[model samples]
Target: MANTPSAKKAARKIERRTEVNRSRRSRVRTFLRKLEDALAAGDATQAQAAFQAAQPELMRAVTKGVIHKNTASRKVSRLAARVRKLSA
Candidate 1:
């Protein structure tokens, strides 16, 4: 369908961008999942470590437009709360 040169170029760019974004999103989710698993396992130390690792990745996702800022904030807040409860 991309008959024009510009359109063809755009298609290629879109494909590349899609792959990059997909990988970023997947990596973010993997971090989140690790945090969740740590929490579920009731290991405060592991959960804290996972949370520490996930926080920056989630923020990066927000900065990269993969996730909303508030969503990331909410996730971090909730995870932090859970970790705090474990520490208490």
Candidate 2:
């Protein structure tokens, strides 16, 4: 509806923010997927490197409010554990 001027402005702002958030989330997921693919391919060194690359992106997603802190932490933990298993 957004009949009020303020409401219309807010709606526009929300649309812009949604796109930005979606892009950030998508970028983070791309990093995670790359790490997962490296792990699945059984390349320990590549997986380790991919995890290192993904860690900061995931943390940045949390800082930017695109993801929750705990969720990001859990993902990083699980990925690190998998990378460790690969190393062993």
Candidate 3:
């Protein structure tokens, strides 16, 4: 329970930030899922395009503090490798 006015305001702020972070996380996941779906379908061109679209979103999530920098980079690297393998 937030008894103090300041505490109540902070709680409200936290609630709003939580919603925003959740939305950002969901958007990033959607981009990742699109890339995964394209990869699973075995379409190299589509996968490449999806990866292109997702790479920036992942990085953006990192910048927004929604995910870690190394985590985003690792995911991008792995996905790029898979896309390259698909093309080859």
Each prediction's TM-score against the native?
A: 0.92, 0.98, 0.97
Span of 10 residues, lowest total lDDT, candidate 1 = 79-88
What does each candidate score in C-alpha RMSD?
1.0, 0.4, 0.6
Q: Flag clash pairs in model 2.
A: none
Q: How close to the true structure is residue 48 of candidate 2, measured as C-alpha lDDT?
A: 92
Q: Model-by-model lDDT, in order?
A: 0.94, 0.96, 0.96
Ranking by TM-score: 2, 3, 1
**Clash statistics: count for each candidate:** 0, 0, 0
lDDT of 3 at 16: 96
Task: Please tell me which predicted candidate would have the highest TM-score against the true structure.
Answer: 2
Model 1 spans > 4 angstroms off: none
Candidate 3's residue-wise lDDT over 1-88, tens digit each? Answer: 9999999999999999999999999999999999999999999999999999999999999999999999999999999999999999
Candidate 1 lands at a TM-score of: 0.92
Native-vs-model 2 lDDT?
0.96
- TM-score result, candidate 3: 0.97
Residue-wise C-alpha lDDT for candidate 2, range 1-88, written one tens digit per residue: 9999999999999999999999999999999999999999999999999999999999999999999999999999999999999999
Looking at model 3, report the run of 10 residues with the lowest lDDT sum. Answer: 31-40
